[model samples]
Target: MENKEVIEPEILKQVAKILKVPVQAIKNFSEEAAVNIISNTFSDESVAYTEYYKYTINPFEKWVDAMDKNEQLFKELLKSEREKIELPEKLLNEKKGNK
Candidate 1:
């Protein structure tokens, strides 16, 4: 893509805060990677919780930590997935696109 659509900086920073991870971890990722992480995350709101068990160490606080983590993870997962999918050349070549 001429331009890759990445997550907003402000939103990514907010997510980083909840995950206790550095903003650069997510911010520095390529747009395609970012898209995958977020898409994979929110693909199924209900299933999102199940995925967390695989990522973290202790029980997350309900409504607060858990929710925040899920949201942040969703964004990251979408980005990761996007990176895997690889934007098609046609889309990437769009005159207005940026990648």
Candidate 2:
């Protein structure tokens, strides 16, 4: 796989503003630390909501349990429906000699 540049300093500065942290902190973060910081910062509300649902409403667990009950049916459907999906002509013809 090719390693492409994904982040720019300006983008990091903007993210720092959203996260309410110093841009230098983001700039100094290692890749893994930066990913964790961004995820935790942005997903605080989502984490709280998930916790609330898990404890108070608990719908997600019920949904997962229901899905687990029908897992075999889902697997069988997936197996029986296996077929090669077609790619667009342009993609298929990207390399010469392709039919």
Candidate 3:
């Protein structure tokens, strides 16, 4: 595979944004180090672009998928916790009402 000689400024900015790090971090990276950083950062488009030095698939897809999974897991956990706390209160309230 062909390696990129230098990463574009715009791409570096995007990577920094995704990683929540300063653009200087990316700029200061050696080419190989930058490539490794992009790959591990999991910014799909950035990773793919760094790999092939071109756009491939939709980069946002991976981010969206990860966010969706997290949201679903959070909802499930909230529901479980709510049930644990509510069940006892529900029983107590019902018993009081019936007495």
Candidate 4:
């Protein structure tokens, strides 16, 4: 609703849902309470650690494979650049020899 009266309660309820707390607890969010909630949530080792990360296959191996591909691509690019530079150099040398 456009009115603060209607929107404030809804906002508080939504915030409570996100925080996993009751609306009553968030109606008056003090600094100390906020700090305590944050500290408690973060003290746990798995605040946002999902199951996907836990069950993933060899991550380092995948990273190494990607790096190998990147290295190969870079080597190809380097060779192409060297050919471009050498082409100009060879053309200049041929012109000098002709003159």
The segments of candidate 1 whose C-alpha lies over 4 angstroms from its true place after superposition are 1-61, 87-99
How do all the candidates rank in terms of TM-score, highest first? 4, 3, 1, 2
What C-alpha lDDT values do all the predictions have?
0.74, 0.71, 0.83, 0.83
Which tens-of-lDDT digit does each residue in 1-99 have in candidate 2? 025356777877788999999998866769888688779877565444554465665799989988997997888777766633334544566755554
Tens-digit lDDT track for model 4 on 1-99? 335544576777887899899887766658898788789998675468776745768889999999999999999999999999999999999999999
- TM-scores for all predictions: 0.26, 0.25, 0.38, 0.44
Pick by lDDT: 1 or 4, better one: 4
Residue 15 error, candidate 3, Å: 52
Backbone N/Cα/C clashes per model: 29, 0, 0, 0
RMSD of 2: 18.8
Q: Write candidate 3's Cα lDDT for 1-99 as tens digits.
A: 028878788987888999999998866758887678867777654333455576577869988999999999999999999999999999999999999
> Candidate 3: minimum summed lDDT over ten consecutive residues — where?
43-52
Candidate 2's TM-score reads 0.25
Instruction: List RMSD in Å for every model shown.
Output: 29.3, 18.8, 15.8, 8.2
lDDT of 1 by residue, 41-81 (tens): 76565344554555755554555887898999999999988
Off by over 4 Å in 3: 1-59
